[model samples]
Target: MQRETTGLLSPGTHVVEVDGLSQRYHVYGSGPVCLAVPGGPGVIWESLRTPALEEFLTMVYVEPLGTGGAQRLSSHPHGYTRERYARNLLGLLDALSLPRAYLLGHSHGGFVAQYFALRHPDRLSGLVLFGSAPVTGPEHMAEAGARVQEFVERNEGQPELPRVLAGLQAVGGATDDEQITAALRDLLPAYLAHYWAREHEFKAWRETLTCTYISGLDEDLTPDTVDDRDALPSLGVPTLVVVGRYDVICGPRWAQELNDLIPGSRLVVLENSGHLAHVEEPEQFAAAIRDFVTETSV
Candidate 1:
């Protein structure tokens, strides 16, 4: 029943084709499973790949529909919804013979994780919500505007500061994919607690990841994730919500909401981190996940 090769048994990344769609999963490590979902909804696995966590857990970096190597089966606008994303996660688990595994969702991926927890709680051993939120649309747009203004005020010397601010406002209302990607580049600096000014590192990262904006995904993400005030608290799954103290995108306020709502979820706010805590503060990030997985697996 397995085409050319669907499940594991390789060192490099591989694809799982089932029911007219293919999901690319980058597998690492050899212990407890942590199905780590990358943010950006379409960003490369590289951004969310954790070498540190792999030392303690089997990390499965998933590329959701419309991102990286993933291919969506349906062209219907409704096909790209959050529930569809959750279904793919569930399908991947079944294809791998993984009855259940830890779900770690970062940024927008956390939204997908939350939906998965709601629909398929029985298939999750635990859940990790990293640098994510409970509600994001107009409020998220407002947050981005505020953050950009704050940074632009102090960084007037940077020639592109004004342009970045313009781009921030533009990305939210972006109609086409090109505008969205350009806006993503303009707003990139705000997500970093460190290396925001490190031109070399920033440039290299931008070059490699580019402006990973997947068309139609913005529609899929924004409108669907309404307030989770009632849903999160009811979740019986063990949960961990990790955030960066300086991450204005998801921010501490949103993280607090998640921790408070998710009954027994543990919250870890790294002192020296922003949007990408796993990259910004690897040691602490890995340690927290290691401890949680160990305790929960027991």
Candidate 2:
């Protein structure tokens, strides 16, 4: 596997020019394309890469509107709402000429995926969410933020961590890049080791870190925009919600709620894993997704 200076997968960088934006994406394997959405507003398309997914489905990892190789927006304000993200995704699909495809999302990407399913049920074949929540409640939001803060404090002294965290905070709307970096340096190691396994893929991890952090800052998780609990119940599509037993970002309760709301949806909780269970245990994650897609194939 070749590495790039940008720390992204060197093999897959296809640009789809849509609405004057050069949307960068990677296509993996061959079959029904699984359009993957990454977590944060700043996160790039590469965050969704996994060895298991590459073998199972043609995964299309997409960079959000203004990050990675995607074209920058010239507007005064950047749009970070779920609706806007979903619309961009639809545009990407249109550009690719894929009338319908499977949907897979991680972290914040799952939020966009859920909204897309609700808005455009006709364009979906299946839905899969890995370690994601649907419209995080106020209580959950505070707890999540606090946990992230604590994680940052614990790992701030590492050399590489500061840069990664600083990029993350910038994406998260932190004006003070130095402060965010200092804070994030303390948190990155635990975050990667426990949640997303950033250590294993160190070469390409910075892109993932910077993108996710910035995206988190840009996100607008309001009640009006993302009401997946109500929307998911009527989705009328095959849905899979995979949660990690040790995931603090999106705890098991979040998955349980989604499972209960979405009719016939399956929820699988992976033990000994955190937020990025797919990366931590790729084989099992891939097998589960393959089985679900196979069963739902038309």
TM-scores of the candidates in the order shown? 0.88, 0.77
Model 1, 184-215: lDDT tens per residue? 77766667675446667567765556334554
Q: Count clashing residue pairs in model 1.
A: 0
Question: What lDDT is obtained when candidate 1 is compared to the true structure?
Answer: 0.76
Residue 79 CA displacement from its true place in model 2, Å: 1.3
Off by over 4 Å in 2: 1-11, 143-173, 176-186, 190-208, 212-225
TM-score of 2: 0.77
